[model samples]
Target: MLLALLGVAAFSLTFPSTAWGLESFGPWSLVALRGVLAALIAGAFLLAGRVPVPDRRHWAGLAVVGGGVVVGFPLLTTLALRTSTTSHAAVVVGLLPLTTAAFAALRTGRRPSRAFWLAALAGAAVVLGYTVRESGGSLSTGDMYLFGALLVCAAGYTEGGRLAAVMPGWQVIGWALVLCLPLAATGAVTALAVEPVRLTAHGALGLGWVAAGSTFLGMYLWYRGMASIGIARASQLQLAQPLLTLVWSVLLLGEELSPAAPVAAAGVLMCIALTQRARS
Candidate 1:
């Protein structure tokens, strides 16, 4: 639980960080560079630890992690950030915990208790209501991207959790990042050539944190937590992530904090507590 909370903390900073990153980098370049940088960091850890290659059976799972996590989520979210505010995007992404729980159930054939499902659904409802109210019941292209990100990221999280049961959690993400290295490198090069660049201190720091902190270390802790608890239970911890992100947006990005944020936070926290106590 501590590990999962830590992971959520790391992820909460991602949207604001991406906003900073966008001050200098185009959406395509930012996403591509993020993948490449994170891959390099993951590669270093794997090589330094002398991690053995994953078995054939794990390759398919790793590929899913590579495509969904290392590529799809970041790309889609970064693109979304181009038009949407960090606070808005964070609220929409609050649905991730529920989505991931559903994916885990389907992938692992494990059924969480009725209480768990109810709590998860309650949390999702809070997020959905907040999102709809915030957006005036209108969905934009950026929302579309974020919605797509939710599905792909949920798939990745489920697969990563499963893989972590058989391997070390860090190695699960480490190898998945390594698997996507070639593609990331190519994308980085191609996107850098086509996209405009205007580097700043904020951009460099944002990029660094997303790569090293969010992508690798965050995932390592998350998978470990999921492996410790069941994925569905652990995923419920993320019910607080959007609120955290909202706070970060105010603190870091200077975004206007919503009046309802506190109420939503309280609701989400209650749901998380219920889900955590519920049987899996």
Candidate 2:
């Protein structure tokens, strides 16, 4: 839970950078650069620490974790955010726990207690209901895009967390960074072909923060928590993120939104707590 919180914090801090990078360079460009830089950052740490290469026993898991979480997630999210506000994206992203819990139960053959199931469902219902109400009974295109990204992200979180359990947190993310190489390269190439960029000083600084904080540190800890605990438990931490994201959006984006943030937060949190207490 501590690790998950750290990951969430890092993500929140860098959340503003996403809009900046997107403005300077499109989402794919930012994602590609983030992947390449994150890999380099992790690799540098590995070399500095002289960490031994992971045994083959862990390779397949790393591949799945890294590919699913690192490469797949960034790409999908960047595309989703192209049309979505960070607040909108955060709402869908909040569903990670519900999705992961379901996946965990299916994978481990562990039967979550009835209370756990109800709480999880209730949380989803609250969030979905609120979203529809806020949007005045219409879901926007951006919402749908983010919803798709969240589905992909849920797969990454569940699988990556499972692998992180046995592997060291840094190693888990490191492996994912490794998996990102080819895909990132392809993305970078495509980005260059379409909209090549040379960052201004401000842009460079933003990218640096994003690489160090969000991609490297944030992602590393998230998978660490996921691996150490089951995804179902780890995902519960995310219930708080959408609220935080809304706060950030109001502060940063200057968007006046629902004044019922506290109520919504409490509802989501209650559901998370209920599910956590109910889970086997």
Candidate 3:
């Protein structure tokens, strides 16, 4: 739980960091560059540990992880941030815990207790209500992108959690990131060529955090925690992530905090407590 909470803390900063990154980079460029940089960092660890290539059967799962977390989620969310406020995007993504739990059940064939599902649903409802109210009860193009990100990221998180059960958590994400290197490199090159670049301190710092801190370190801690607990249970912990992000947005991005934020946070935390106590 400690590990997972740390990972959530890292992720909570992603939107604000991406906002900083956009000060100098186009959405495509930011995604591609972060992928490449993260892959390189992962590769270094793999090399230092002299990790052998994973079994052939594992490659397919790793591919899904790469495609979802490394590519699809980052690309879509970054694009969405082009028009969406960090707070708005954060609330929309608050649905991730429920989505991830559903994916875990489908993929792992392990049903959590009824109480768990009920709590998860309640948490989702709170988040959904907060999101709808924040957006004036209407969806936007960015919401579409955020919803897409939720699906893909849930798939990635589920797969990564499963793989982590059989292998070291770091190796799971490390190999996945390495597998994405060629595509990331190609995209980075093309994006750098096409997108205008105006470097700033915030942009550099943002790129650094998203790549190393969020992508690599955060995933490492998250998968490890999932392996220690269980995927569905660990995923429930992410119910707190959106609240954390909202706090970060207010502190780091100078965004106004919604009055409903504290209420939503309290509700989500209660749901998380219920899910944690429920049997699997």
Candidate 4:
């Protein structure tokens, strides 16, 4: 639980950081550069630690982790944030825990209790309500991108959680990063070729945070927690992420906090706590 909370704390800054990066970088550029940078750092860690590579059978699972997290989630979320506010993105992303739970069930055939389901549903409803209210009661293209990001991210999280049981959590994410190296390198080079970039301090800071913290370190802690506690329960911790992100959005991006924001956060947090306490 503590490890997972640490991961969530790291992740909570991502949306606002990405928003900051988008000021000077194209969404694709940011995503591509971040992925490549993360992969490089992860590769260095693997090399320094002398970590053995996974066997052939596990390579497929690693690919899923890489594709969903190193590729899809970052790309989709960056695209979404191009047209969305950090707060809007945070509200939509608040559904991630429920999605993660659903994916965990599918991946592991672990059935949560009725009480857990109810609490998860209630939390989802609160987040959806917040999203709709923030977006003025209508869905937009940003929402679609965010939804896509959630699905892929859930799959990656579930798969990584499962693998973390038998492997070091850091190695799980590191291997995924190495697996993504070629593609990430290609994308980064292509993005740079197409659009030249002049990096500002803010953009560099945001890029550094997401590439290092979100892509590798946070995932390490998150998968470790999931391995220990199981995915369904660990996912409940994600319930607090949006509230944290909202706080960062206000502080970093100067976004106005709505009165309803805290209310919805409190409601969702209660449902998360209920789910956490319910029998699995």
- What are the per-residue Cα lDDT tens digits for candidate 1 across 1-280? 8998899999999999999999989988888888889999989989999989999999999999888889999999999998999999998999999999999989999999999999999999999898888888888899999999999999999999999999999999999998998898898899999899999999998998889989999999999998998799888888888989998999998999778888888999999999989997
Task: Mark the 10 consecutive residues where model 4 has the least summed lDDT.
Answer: 19-28
- TM-score for candidate 4, residues paired by index: 0.98
lDDT of 4 by residue, 91-173 (tens): 89999999999999998999999999999999999999988987888999999999999999999999999999889999999
Candidate 1 vs candidate 3, lDDT winner: 3
lDDT of 2 at 174: 77
At residue 186, candidate 3 shows an lDDT of 95
TM-score of 3: 0.99
lDDT of 4 at 232: 92
Can you write out model 2's per-residue Cα lDDT over 1-280, one digit (the tens) per residue? 7888888877775556676677677777888888888888888888887878878887776776666566666666667677777776777677767887887777667677788778888888777777777777888776766676666667666666766666677777776786677887788889867885766665676677777788789878887876765677777777877878788788876766676656778899898778668756
Extract clashing residue pairs from model 3.
none
| CA lDDT scores, all candidates in order | 0.92, 0.74, 0.94, 0.91
RMSD score of candidate 3 (Å): 0.7
Q: What is the lDDT of residue 254 in candidate 4?
A: 92
Q: Which candidate do you rate higher for TM-score, 2 or 3?
A: 3
**TM-scores of all models?**
0.99, 0.89, 0.99, 0.98
What would the C-alpha RMSD of candidate 1 be, to one decimal place?
Answer: 0.8
